[model samples]
Target: MRRIIILLLLLVIALGSAGAVWAHGVKITYTVTFSPTIAIEAAYDTGEPMANAQVIVYAPDDPKTPWLTGECDDDGRFSFSPDPSKPGTWEIQVRQAGHGEWLKIPLDEEMMQSGQGVVTEGGDEGFSTAQIVLMSACVIWGFVGTALFFQSRRPPAQEPGEAA
Candidate 1:
């Protein structure tokens, strides 16, 4: 019975690790256009082939209705045109089988003002290089602190003949 329990635990651990790798391995890219037309393009992170993944474009202000929907190609690419006549910010929601989560990409005003892309209100826009750098630094510091915490928890090795 103990052997069976150990085997089951090992199998669970292996499967969990595999699932984590698969989830992090796949990357979704979203390119949204707000001007000339409201459209979106998507591709995989590794540039791997993709097919049949659903791409939904919605009004960020109103998630109840999606303006456009389409399936990705075998090349891991998908496109959607949401009523060109309607203007403003938009949000993209992407989903693929085995991905297990929805990927959300925002099209903000700065991207639209660039004269080639669409923009959505309240979406990320005009992020300066300094802001990016600061955010990156914060993330790095957070990871460093977490690592230090675990390292400190490890028990110190006792010297020979040391008291128990």
Candidate 2:
């Protein structure tokens, strides 16, 4: 019948047009990677990591001379172990290309007896859990809002018997 043929043609056209609508949108994937960080970091007063620094150590007896000399790694960390035999006070001096810092460590009876080295520096990890959750919520809301807006703008469907 003519009505059946017309209906099939309209259905084909509608499906073809719907395909065009689907083809109009774009799918873009953005991947973000957060790598794990190394430990033992030195920082300035502003909390910026100090990289490639010169590290020097001085014994309590020798105040004017350096006992040990080394350079900090890329992570701004200069690992060193003090002498257990020299039980007094030890000074550590860290200097970059220009900036510098000095820390005086006391090797008292209790500390020397314990034989445990203290950790003076540490690195700051990435974003907190709350921050990640907030960002994910924002992105989800943006996607949902965009989908709703597009859905509202779509053309209403035509009934089988509706006039053109």
Candidate 3:
């Protein structure tokens, strides 16, 4: 019985840890630096180097300005030279192929000059509604199965006529 209790507690902890990981959103970190030239570094949510991710920079004054563009390398990094003559607030946008959401980052002159940009995917750290419902159902079914399994494994009751 004690072993069963310990096992149950361990199982609960393991499941909770797994759920936490699933609930956490993805993160991307990069830097926007100016050396009279523009430089950037980007990484994917998985932390694995991402190559070919699209990155676009737009000057705040004129969104239509021929924006600078670059693609992340195998190490998930990219750098480009922005028109130094045009210095103003800039918007950085990144998108991975097949990913529906575009990460929009705003950088002021100070930030651009200092070179810092950090963006995280999925703002919230929690399961979606559908996922929550499915997980609840799974837990309930697991408990019901455990109970039935124990019941089935129990020894049969002894008859009154049987010797002690």
* Lowest lDDT block of 10, candidate 2: 25-34
Q: lDDT per residue, candidate 1, 1-164, as tens digits?
A: 35445755775575445422322234454555445343333334333445666777676567768767777666656655544443455566667765522455544455545556433322222234466456655875676567667756864454577776
Model 3 residue 45 CA deviation (Å) reads 2.3
The estimated TM-scores of all candidates read 0.43, 0.44, 0.46
Q: All models: lDDT?
A: 0.52, 0.54, 0.55
Q: Worst 10-residue stretch by lDDT in candidate 3?
A: 117-126
Segments of candidate 1 deviating more than 4 angstroms: 1-41, 98-156, 159-164
Give the Cα error of residue 113 in candidate 2, in Å.
Answer: 3.5
Q: Which residue pairs in candidate 2 collide?
A: none
lDDT of 2: 0.54
Tell me each candidate's RMSD, in Å, in order. Answer: 10.4, 18.2, 10.2
**Which scores greater on TM-score, model 2 or model 3?**
3
Model 3, residue 102: what's the lDDT?
35
lDDT of 3 by residue, 28-48 (tens): 554444453444445443344
lDDT of 3 at 99: 44
Estimate the TM-score for candidate 3: 0.46
